[model samples]
Target chain A: MGASSPDLIVHVDTFARVNMVYEVLSVISVIMLLAASLAVLITYNWRVCVLSLAVQYLAAFWLINLDYPLAMAAVKLVVGWMVCAMLGATPVDLKQPDEQLPGRLFRLLASAMVWILVFSIAPSVLQWVPTGMVILWGGLALIGMGLLQIGMTTFAPRIVVGLLTILSGFEILYSVLESSVLVVGLLAIVNLGMALAGSYLMTVSGGLEV
Target chain B: MNAPLIWIVFPVIVSVILFFLSARRYLVVGLATGSNLFFVLLGLLLPIDRLIKLGPWAFEVSSTLMVFGRKFVITDSDAHLVVFLYFFAAFWFFGAGVVRAHRLFIPIGQCMVAIAVAAISVEPFLYAGLLIEVAVLLSVPMLVPPGRRVGQGVLRYLIFQTLALPFVLYAGWVSAGVEANPANQRLLQQGVVLLGLGFAFWLAVFPFHSWVPILVGEAQPYVSGFLLSLLQTVVLLLMLGFLDSFAWLRDFSVLSQVLQLVGTIMVASAGIMAAFQRDVARLFGQAVILESGFALLALSVPGYQGAEVFAGFFAGRLLALALWALALSNLAADGISFGFDHLKGLLHRLPLTSIAVVLSVFSIAGLPLLASFPVRLMLFDRLIPEAVNAVIWVMIGCLGMLMGGIRTMMVVAHSQEGWRFEERLPPAILMAIGLLGLVIIGIFPRWIMPYLIQLLDPFQSLGVLMILPLI
Candidate 1:
């Protein structure tokens, strides 16, 4: 407890706060991803998972509000939710080892992986590419994600895939043009509306099943 | 911007609330139909100007009006199409309500309204694909049987539609990118191929046409009619919009030729299939496919008149088909099969229903004074010149359609000596409307021409005069 140590303490506290912010955002995103995954696994008993994931998704939104990088993280959470939920609900166990089906599934997985990789390295990739190429890359990546989701057996997945593709295309376009928050906000609203619709269909379809 | 949009929105809101209230109950059907009728009325009364809004993000509404500019035009031509679609939707929706529980009808109708509005209002006009897909999905429950086939038809329908998305997106990309040349030769070629394939898929053309019969064979007749007639008509309107909005599309001779080739193939194949079909429902399905082919063939003929004729023929055929499907569905109820043998004594057993069937089948066959007769004559005239050396193919298709009609009439007209009458005739209103439509449109072909021309104008250049001077 010397007078000189107070300045050092203050510096350490600021550094810790920055680390805490990043850690919290990262944790929030991971939890969302996990929750989305769990929703897919127990989709037969979907209401509880849907409700839980929806809440987790809201918390993720708060994380993104506190930290911008977490916004990009939300896309993965949604995709994870969709893909996992689809796999959980599908009668994949009884299905044969048809090459076409497995090939499609593998392609979907590969596409998702490729998209995530692309997004992870997008900042570095941007430095190497021209504006048009950047837009093209971003669009293709989002589209790939969409295409993957669409390839699934379920209707909810297909609808979600369509919305995601549209979102990806819009996001790429936004990035290329450096669009204003208003456009982004509207786009987010549209995406959210689509998600709500997809969720509603899942509910109705659940009734159809019973 | 127009008050009628309010009319469209308000009823939808009310119906949605009602639908939720009904839950899994039958009340949803009535509320949905009532709401759909309200939407139809809005379309009928709303002015074109009031129906459209022009801005960065525009919305339009009106009663008996034309709201938007020439860039996104909705002339008097759309009146009949809209009116017919509304009533057709209402009729089928009500019929479906009576027979089945389709919770999607209300939402589907709303999507239809959105599609119609978007088609009437959008610029460069390629956005219809997304809206149409939405409509198709909204129609899923109606296409497949509720219990066992709960998701199959809709699933297949969805997959087929998904296939169309990329083709359309590619077309849009091509159109957007190919600006230096208004018509991109390669892009146009790609577009012609893609659109021809895309529409053929939508229309269930030939080899890819399995979905049509499969759906009709399984779903309730009312649902089948809505898909075949009302929903299909909207898709046709969307195609018309695309051809109308883009000068480059209309200018491409290759595109027209492709449409002819596809249309010809479809007619020939579908007609042959229809002629050999044992299922009555499937016969009707095949008949729709053939009619769709004829429409494509008519669209292939180059000239403003050809385009106008195509529009008129499409509108007329849609009305006829809707009536036909409605009658056919009722005829099939009570363990009815599509086989000729099953319908052998339909005349004596179900006289009113038989008559409704007769009117629908005959009208579709282009019987004189029926709604479709004039349209077919006009379509054949245009298609014949384009067929050149292959003239007989078109003839065979037409003849096949006629033969199918004759077969249905012959089968339904006879009464078996020992057969007992059990099934009662459907309500008189359906029969009266079908017969009246047949006779009125057949006798007075000119009655609907002006309105048809107005609808066609957006696609082609039209003159006010009845007959056009050579360009």
Candidate 2:
């Protein structure tokens, strides 16, 4: 694609053959993404949260591949899993006696609302995004839930995870729009950097060390 | 050597070396200072795509470096950016040891600068968002050293800065579409909204500025000051690039008005907020925000003059912020609270440091015979007719920040401690240099103002109004 052509840069990968298995997988990926994000929102167990986060990257990878070349797309999955490993290595202490806890049911309801909002709005928003329905639903759900997670907590770990989730969602959307190697590399760096930063924060902030 | 190699790769390599010797404060500062000085010289002496002859042997430096199918290109017009960034880095690095900043300050700060350069040189501007994100991540460790608990301020800052990424990426796509067909009102609207949101979050323009003061309150003074100054300047530079790249976006009639309004709001709100802050460090943050507002207002001026005035603010802002941060570093060395009560009558104890703090504050407030006065005047001259109400609000904002300075001064002066200068010699000398630089710039704005204004010359359309009017 010419840089200043003033023409739309169509993606070659978007022309992939539509198969039933891939279609089923895409639907499963969106569902899995929603479940993973919801799990992250309400779960107190750091282990479960990390596992849900891992599942998120997995779902993200499945959908992102629809738009990006398989090899370039797998970079996200690798980086996301690596980020999970780094965070998992860090001991996270989520329990604070002095902090007031919002009821779990309230959290569940809030997340459910986020799911409904994103899933409902996905079709309307799809007019702008040039990707498949799988990407639209999965991306919106991750963004909404990521925002909810960020808004609901001040804890360093939770905030970091939320940021990562949001980034994953954004990458899914951006992959369809951009195919620049530099953009991909820089984003991968951002993900790894954020994870390192989060671990550093946890280490310094007195979170439990594994 | 190419621009990226000279500005980006060299800095990263040096930063890695600095990391190994980071524990040795003096050595790290010395190396960083010297290397940054080298970079400034390189920026001054080296011309991209032009041959240089030194002692008979000659070599031409290329502008573009290809890596992994991507181009990191810094053209000749961008050379001044190298000059500006490193000169300030050298200035701050020179004083790092005197202030007893964290050992990681030099190494991490250098890494951030390298990442900043990468953000600047990347081929497609959209790629910059992620590079900037990495830079923000690097700041976390520098701001919060070991044993220091992370505050909501840092987290908020992280999240807020991160939030700009997606909006900017999406906007890049929309803008591409708009460029293809500028007549698509719906596409244009979508582009404008996304772009505005991206910049708003990135710049922390009004109402979204809580993180600035809060982070200032929580982090070390020098670290926060350096990061804010660097990040804000780079973001502004990026915005200029956006405007320069998109004629459609620039011609969108409301862009100027929107900028002026946002700038006015940030200035007024920050000033009012500064007046109410009990903690002096938080006030410093508001001062930073006010400066950001001023830069935005400067950019809103009718023509290339606006860009010049915008660029002209750099030297003054850098000096003032460095002075302010360095002074605060000296004043808050005891690890004591930054509350007014704790700082009561501190003037008697640290006279030079106290004076440095006040002068820096007043300078940022656009006090006469200070660094910011001339550019502020240039902005007001053109801005008033267009935005009288905004100008009035800005003056009120200026007064509020001045009031903050006055309040701080009164408290520092009222202390009961016996009159004595307790500041160490090295830090006092650094503060003196900063103060002297500010005053010198203020007294003879003509000496430096023209050079600073030249920063916009590379952007052809933006530089069309290169002839600066006499202030």
Candidate 3:
């Protein structure tokens, strides 16, 4: 083969480097998403649960950025963090130190099945939703785990976190489909409303002012 | 002048102001009632997109308002719906104090109404899911205000409603794609199925309906009645909006058959279940389900026949449900048991309220002279040829509801003690007015129903699908 020109060499090198950056980021996002959601499901510590939620949103931000600019995708990150902060600060004793060791192990085992189900269904979901592989995996994973979380708990704080996680998952999937500014704004409003509603339930059930 | 600005945005602004003024309960009630009344009048009197001159002052109310690249359109055809909504809202607000509803009732109520209107009027229509979700969230505070533990009913409501959001938005997206390529049979099926599931959750169809009685039982009857009434009505109307707008979906005859099947299940289940209910609060929930059943049945009818009955259902439902809820609220205020067994001899203590309760239930059951009877009869007449089995089950459902009503009346009227008139003035008057309204509607439906039937005019293509029940 003939020697490549200097300009062509630079162009080829830049293309490979860009692909490398994407591959690295994708792996990181996948890792963060999986670790965060599993932690949320298994942890009873409120601080750990809240931190995992924030980190899950970070994974969400990365997935969303695949479709939108960093500035636009930041809406999901900011709103998700705000929700985490709000629910985390509630006066109610959300720190449920009550579940036995078996319960945590059971949740972990159940979540394993959920992950299996997500992988099994992601191919089918892709056929209909028309999103990227990373998104399909991350979005479906979050949704499946989030639903598992909601199903496992009756406490307001956990339910709200689960709802936000599911919403963020949906946002990731939907961001790739439609780019309407208003839809993004409305979805953000929904996240905040869910958090506010959770806080209200917590404060009231914890006790007084009606 | 803009139609959306007047009907949609104005209520939101009012709600915000009312939220701050809520501590002044009387002022909030007055403002909510006045604002709703104003909306009713404006909807009835003004013609959208038409200029008129009065003493050299002229203005035209435009139909569409664009914001953030999306359109909110409220046209002349939609005026009747706006009128119906606010008119019913005013009725509820006017009775707020008598029911001793929370001070937040009016403000949060107006917010619910505004969000509901937005759900109806939002363009591209897909955005309706988010708006509806907002409306659902707003209901939380009302259902579980400060000082009360969040009931399982509220939690379930939140989860079920949240779950519906994804299905609806996803279905809308799917349908949009299918519309671009109509030959995609698999995608079409998926879209239809998703939309059907979304409606099932939103409207609380049979299997998903556990939350209905639970919610009505746990929360105050007035609040539950208002929320369920608005939620169901809007969702039904939104379903109609979908039918009117989407050709591929509506064109499928399977849609009608499915709706009929679903409607029959809801009615039969609600009615049969209502018969066994001991608590009046739960009975109210069943009553709501029964009405929803009838509305669905109306849509399942061959054509415009279903639509008229459907529209008429909306008109009759508000009066019957309002009266039923109002009567129930009045009884609740006296600290009486909602359980029929424990409520023996309540008629002697609160005769007007007891009568109101029985009459409202009787009306919902489609008794001969109730507001819903004419519509129910019309629906039966249409369903007879199409699905005799449905008619049989529906009648059974109707009879079941009527049986529940009779049981309530029996409990209310009989007592070991002597009969006494212990009802106070304000509630007695309110109950009496509702009773009269139901009677008038039952006797002369045409007078009022014509107005509500026009609610379907906004859904031009669904013109053949007039109201079995408007919200």
Fraction of native contacts under 8 Å reproduced by each candidate: 0.00, 0.88, 0.63
Per-residue accuracy of model 2 over B1-471 as CA lDDT, tens digit each: 788988999899999999999888888898999999999898888888988898989998999989888788888878887788888888888888888899888999998988888887786677787788889999999999997778878988999999998988888888889999999988888887888898888888876778988888888899999999999989998888888888888888888998899899989988888777777788889998899999889888867878878887998888998888888888767565688888887888788888888888899899999999988998899888878999999999999989998988898899655887677889888888888999999989989977776677566777543576476
TM-score of 1: 0.70
lDDT, candidate 2, A1-210, per-residue tens: 454433333333343334545866799999899889888887878888899999999999988888788998899999999999999998887754343365667878898898889878888888788667788888888998899999988888989999999999988888888887778888998999999999899888877421
DockQ for all models: 0.07, 0.55, 0.54
For model 2, the local distance difference test gives: 0.85
Fill in the DockQ of model 2: 0.55
lDDT of 1 by residue, B1-471 (tens): 443344434544664575466455456656656766766675566655544544666654433323232123343445545555556556665665444435555555544554555445444455455445555655654454234333444444655654564455446545654445664476566666667666766777767777777667767766666677765666676776667656677777677777777788877887777667766777778778877887777667766666666666754576666666766666655667767889887877766667766666667666776787787777666666556644467667767766777787788777646545555434446556667877887788777676666555444442323543111
Off by over 4 Å in 3: A1-24, A95-99, A207-210, B465-471
Residue B456 deviation, candidate 1, in Å? 2.9
lDDT of 1 by residue, A12-125 (tens): 999989967665555545444334433332233444434544444454343333323555546534643553354334322212233555654565466557556756766654
Query: Where does model 2 exceed 4 Å of error?
Result: A1-21, A96-102, A208-210, B416-418, B464-466
Better of 1 and 3 by lDDT: 3
RMSD from true fold, candidate 3: 3.2
Q: Write model 3 residue lDDT over B1-471, tens digit each, in one string.
A: 799999888999999999999898778888899999999998889988999778989988899999899999998888878887888788899898778898778889998888888889999999999999998988899998776667878888998899899889989888898899988999899999999899888988889988889898888889999999898989989988888888898787698889899999999999999899888999999999889888888888755666777777887798888888887788778887699877899888888888888988899999988888888888887789879998999999999999999999898888989977889899889888888888888888778876776888987776553344432
- Specify the poorest-scoring 10-residue window by lDDT in model 3 chain A: A91-100
